[model samples]
Target: MGVHHHKIGGGKLLIAIVLNLILTVVQIVGGIISGSLALLSDALHNFSDVSALTISHVAHTLSSKKATVKETFGYKRAEIIAALFNASVLIAIGIYLIYESFVRFYDPQPVVSVWVVGLGMLGVIVNGGSIWLLEAEAKGNMNIRAAYLHLLGDTLTSVAVVAGGAAMYFWHIYWIDPLISIAIALYLIYASLSLVKESTGVLMEFVPEDLDVEEIAEAVAREPDIKNIHHLHIWRINDREVFLQAHLDFEQNLSLQEVTRRIEKIEKMLKHRFGISHAVLQPEFMRDDEKDLIKGES
Candidate 1:
């Protein structure tokens, strides 16, 4: 099967980017006119969404290109790279927002609540639509997940702005508007940093958190024709592919056909049981080599 099976393409992402661009501009104007920090922060989040979605769209398109000798993995990793960049950008923006919130608190101002509520409502609608478009693809792909989380978080932030603006309009609680912006910043920091760690793990070729090496060794050792499995390495090439390679010491000298058959059987078992998408085995009769489960990173 293809790497991008069931994944969305660039066209939907383009639409999302366009929607966010428009929302960002409108919210910025409204924020400036109303002197509302909440509106300005919402506009900032929308702008980040536009940047993230644009990166996601480019990566999504590149990932579909056919692999070649110069790029054997094709562009499958483009999504992971995009995700890392977007997440880092988000964290920086979050920190900046926090600093701005402090400044706003230090110098309080009267905000026009009507514009805050109105632009906030617009934020909800635009981000909601973007979320709808990208929701399905986010589960399996980290790149899209980063962008989706931006939309998801911003949608909630917009809701908070509307609530805070309502308080300011009716109860003279203008101080709460900066607090709303702070809340948005805190959430952005939390979500984006987590994604940054995940993307880093994938890029470092760390063993997937879900799979254990000893369990795999035990399963392979259980094979009647196999003596032991050693020097095992398991890592994900991207979000969707997990690759494993090991040296399998056989019980005795066996025919080439028999060895191939046993290898195929082990491959199938790994796929069915562990969701390992790719497996490579080196058959050995009595070769003197490392017997440890993990020698070092390959």
Candidate 2:
């Protein structure tokens, strides 16, 4: 029926956004003064995280709107769109950081070790707090998942910066800074690509990966008075909810009341067998038509 809102409060997200913005500015300035590319990269990632969280918060609000004639689905897909945008941004930032890290390798700059270490440790604390705040909501929502990934990336990058700073300070290994940046960028890319693919699937209305249309049709045909099932379609509303639609052929022409009862039975079967949250069915009697399990493109 309806989407369930997580127990998370807008106040918690607002707190996270404020913290990230303040720390991002601090890190950027510190990166410039300290000449730390790793620190600068972490700051950039933190900035992206801030942007992602703001988009998610707005989408979460929009998703609560009711459906209308012009927008039959209302703003339900807003969160999915936000998730796609956030994932795309993460991938772009990751690529830029990787390229920058490679360039830095050729001309490694000497960073002030104390500044990098101090800012990095502060980053870890700040990002860790933000992660805690969004952890619960992220589990069931793709938009929140993108935001969570950003914070998790930032936390990991902060740790990397600290490690690189320590290595450079003790052993004078300046190359470690770019090395850590490269590693963080690669990891971010790897993690965010999955989100991009999943969000894209939803936007494209692709069938859920776990569902088998043939199996569902066979199961529905098992009900008495049902001749066959065809024109089956399934897709996700978001990460948690699934929507299914299909046409059913019956052995006999039934009254409106009997048809309604059969429809309810089919809906219950779909929900129990496939975790389908919503279903639409069209009943037919001895209609001559194609009965393909999946409708082929004309």
Candidate 3:
């Protein structure tokens, strides 16, 4: 299911990648000729969009590959890795923009407002279209969301450039260039932080933020003939797929057939209640073991 979904995302990413690659070159040249720091900052941000989209495209492609014995989970996590990489780049670029803005604040340079306004208008159109293209898929997929954010940030920066250009043209307020750059940097940092936190949490094997182990155990305990559930662990394979493992103690020394039927019911309960995609439960009857829900020295 994930592979098919990624295949659809691939087409949108390809279009965005090509568009951003072209826009990056145009913005860089335009920024240089216009002497607009804000325009240069937008160009740098656009370049990151190109790189991020490319990474996402590759990840989507890799995710479509079948699982092998060597890599049992397949490449579903490729998109998660791409999301991490994109968010990290966003932070680095944001820091760089802020530093550049401080330098510009000290010694503001005069810009050609005509060139700045004209190129910034073109940027708005290009980035806006890219945002529209990716908006539908961005809702559910973190990789797409990061790429969408790159385009959204670029759109906002382009708007800022247009405003700054007007300000410079009317009042000769050169410092507005740095001010707009600073605003763009702050926004990028704010937007990228959650993606960075989520991706890092997944990489570190932390339990998914929305899930509660105790709540899950309590829910499962409601089933018939269940003595207790313990030694339970849950984690996500990606944004959509969650895997669980646990020990299930039974009240009766049931037959193998009865145990299988009971286990099937519990699996269904987990799937319906918790959205767990895979479950590996160890069934036990009248066996002595550590009964803690979380079985480890705390």
lDDT of 3 by residue, 42-147 (tens): 9999999999999988987887788999998889899899999999899899999999999999999999998888888988999999999889899888878888
Worst 10 residues of 3 by lDDT: 1-10
Can you give the TM-score per candidate against the true fold?
0.96, 0.96, 0.97
- Measure candidate 1: CA RMSD: 1.9
Maximum-TM-score candidate = 3
TM-score: which is higher, 2 or 3?
3
Question: What do the candidate models score in CA lDDT, each in turn?
Answer: 0.90, 0.90, 0.90
Q: Lowest-lDDT window of 10 residues in candidate 2? A: 1-10
How many residue pairs clash in each candidate at the backbone level?
Answer: 0, 0, 0
lDDT of 1 by residue, 79-174 (tens): 999999999998888899889888888787899999999989989999999899988888888989989988998999899999999999999788
Kindly list the per-residue Cα lDDT of model 2 for residues 1-298, writing each as its tens digit: 3344432545567788999999999999999999999999999999998898899888887887888999888788898999999999999998999899999999998889899999999999999999999898888888888889999999999999999999989998998999999999999999999999999999999987888877888889999899988898899987878999989998999998999999999899899989999999999998999988788845
Q: What is the TM-score (0 to 1) of candidate 2? A: 0.96
Instruction: Give me the runs in candidate 1 sitting further than 4 Å from their true place.
Output: 1-7, 296-298
Residue 22 shift from truth in candidate 3, angstroms: 0.9
